[model samples]
Target: MGPEGGGDALLRLEGVSKRYRRSGLLALDDVSIWVGAGERVGLMGPSGSGKSTLACIAAGLLSPNAGHVRFDGVERSGGGRLPRGRSAAVRRAWLGMQMVFQDPEASFIPTMRLGDAVFEGARYLPRFKGADKDRLVREALEAVELPGSYAERFPYELSGGECQRAAIARAVIGRPKLLLCDEATSALDVTVQAKVMALLGRVHRELGTAFLFIGHNPALVGGFCDRIYRIGGGRITEELEACERP
Candidate 1:
């Protein structure tokens, strides 16, 4: 099933469930959610409430134990895997979506220059085929409010906030249709969080990309999303609209 209230969604999770085999812990239970094209959706919960688990599943980084994940009308069921010959399907799944993690510094390779790190994924994108690496890296950095000079620096050289902005630059450079941000701003101070949020807002507006903004902070999520869903104990406890956010 698609999202309630109209237009075809870019991503949909229907009755999805996940459980860790090692600890025998249920991280998600019958979770259903959707994000429409260019829509901003928020998933909010406390720590250990299955927030990151759901994000990982939605992004196809992890498989759900049950239920279906639909992206752009294609469906991937529980425990499903893309077959070896399905190159197009694989490309659709990967190139159209991107994820940003909580720790920006850890997201990159310490040995690589920031410019190469940011352009690595994007270079394979069809739109950037034959595109100049330096130009793409500079433009991506500029979009994230970073100077082009910073691209020569390594991940260790940047502050947390700066590194996060670079991560955002890397994620957006590919022009992904959906961006899954898992605790993207939690590591930053209040002021830096605001700035990062503002940068995200600009990215969304300019690129018209849909977002699944996952975090523990209700205030931050509510401020950025059009709709909010609250999860607790591995289940969705509440759904809040932008106007109804608390």
Candidate 2:
């Protein structure tokens, strides 16, 4: 079994269940999982196995028909609560939660400059404006090791790896306490995938962000995650603890 949830867990999904109205699909069934502060948790299963649905609910985008979500010890149902509340607008307020998608191209706005897009999330942070904002934008770009000049370039002007890195940069800029990644490296080639993994490693080890990583590769999960949960048919079927690290 995985470690139990309590006051220390940064995020928790308890007895969570969801059904897609349009498809009449039971996306999740009595699933319970938790991520502790600064911990790395891996969720893995094959495609069409409700991994993305779980991610959506965790991010507070989709409401579950049953069960509850808790962030920072507060339980949320129908939707998640932010620092102050859980209205639709509050959901968008981004209270310590962020997501990184697999397809970076689809996530970015075509017309927006890369720099503008990367720092957009930090606008939600308090005391964020002027020099600090600009500095954050640059720092976020640098976090992914993208060149300063690349910030001014459009997403179309960059390679896939660069764009994906920018997407990660955007996700990390706000310094969200928890990052829910839905196959964040699937679109990149092997080399770029390694780079993204390394970036995520630093984000996990250095920034103290609890990560709920959704992916298919077991090896990758073992390297970065403290615990690995195998989710199947909308429920967690197994939990694998990481091997002792050097």
Candidate 3:
């Protein structure tokens, strides 16, 4: 399976490839995928099959050896080079994207309070500045079922599930158009994972945010995604529609 009709997609990756220099391993090979606006797409693969690598590349956190990443109809970057000056400025203003990692604790600053970490990104935006920032943060936390008071506590103080919820609050505070979930629920317990999945569903419905859910669990991916891509051996081997799952 390769990139399908994505002219109107919110995120598009074309012929992407990534190779690690130290290990000389090809983590991804000619991978192509797309997530349309408010669409839920899943990437499923076993460990070390390049699922996380693909997620990082999509999030613009890792540079691919070859390929093009387009977001909102604009080319993001290629060949380890990032946009600069005018291009970078325009991108910053329209930065309607966010990513949540598997380990929520790792996403936070160990020394920072939970509230400050959640407000970090929002504070940079014009609408979330000053008093509005606090309100926005509280609203985000509330949406994630986290108490506003929990914001005062540090990341180490919350349980794993609670921390994950906080991480979600941080990601959604900006009302991103694209949300990347890189094994976001893998670290939680089975019961907690279900709760988190439900929460993500609610968030998607309320915000209409497109999602690229990367994980290894077929059951989880099948349950949450509208379409699923099976990535293995560093490439997408199959694609499945909702009715075709399992």
Candidate 4:
């Protein structure tokens, strides 16, 4: 990746804003952020600072009231309704812009086997089938250090840390260009969090996947990301190239 706005950016958010209808709260305010191809960027903020809200807009999960989201050099905006085909294209981009939430259990399909759940989203990709699909699932699980036999198990059979690892596996299975981690390791015990953090680093290094880590922890972000942005009041307040790590 080159300088901030130089070419080769994988994702970029330009002057985005969002507000909630219920309470009329402004969640994001003219926020601009970018992640270059294979770059690991970190976002840190206090609770309710809207880092997660910005992540949603960046991933196309929620549309912003203003500004645009650009991915793979294609500019997309959540500021307004899009044409049906454009919406579908956004959804397709989302498949490659996977996210892992704080609670893995909340995202699981209780009835589906772990392997099947991991492979669920990839079937839509053209000609991705049979042995290739199966291999992808197994490889993804292995990437997160989950045992091969875990694939046959169900979500209830795994511990919290194990489930989170499975969640990482599921996200990477699609070979996403961007990975959004919203407090992904915050729920785990210290030891388990360390393991998950290590797994994330390994994934970033091995896959060359750009990661946008959203959390309140400065040390975690400092240790993992190449660039760090601090957010408050729905806007990026500071850019810190150095922070105390680990």
Estimate TM-scores for all models. 0.93, 0.90, 0.93, 0.91
Counting clashing residue pairs in each candidate, in order, gives 0, 0, 0, 0
Q: In model 4, where is the ten-residue run with the lowest total lDDT?
A: 76-85
Off by over 4 Å in 1: 1-7, 77-81, 244-246
Higher-ranked by lDDT: 2 or 3: 3
lDDT per residue (tens digit) for residues 1-246 in model 1: 225653478888888999899999999999988888888999999999999999888877789999888777677644555545666756566567889999999999999999999997597777777888898899899989899998899999999999999999999998899999999999999999989998999888889988999998767888888888899999999987866322
RMSD of 1: 2.4
What number of backbone clashes does candidate 2 have, counting pairs of residues 3 or more apart or in separate chains? 0
Predicted candidate 4 versus true structure: per-residue lDDT over 83-106, tens digit per residue? 456655565665678899998988
User: Which ten-residue region of model 2 has the weakest summed lDDT?
Assistant: 85-94
lDDT of 3 by residue, 1-246 (tens): 224577777888899999999999999999998988888999998899999999888878889999898887777656534566646455753468799999999899999998889987566666654566667778888989999888789999999999999999998888888889999999999999999999999888889988999998877888888898899989999977755322
**Local error of candidate 1 at residue 77 (angstroms):** 5.6
Instruction: State residue 96's C-alpha deviation in candidate 3, in Å.
Output: 1.0
Clashing pairs in 2: none
Error of 2 at 163 (Å): 1.0
Q: Candidate 4 — which residues are off by over 4 angstroms?
A: 77-82, 86-94, 243-246
TM-score of 3: 0.93
Query: Model 4 — TM-score against the truth?
Result: 0.91
lDDT against the true structure, per candidate, is 0.86, 0.82, 0.85, 0.83
Residues 149-224, model 2: lDDT tens digits: 7778998998988888899899888788889989988888899999888889888777888889999988887777
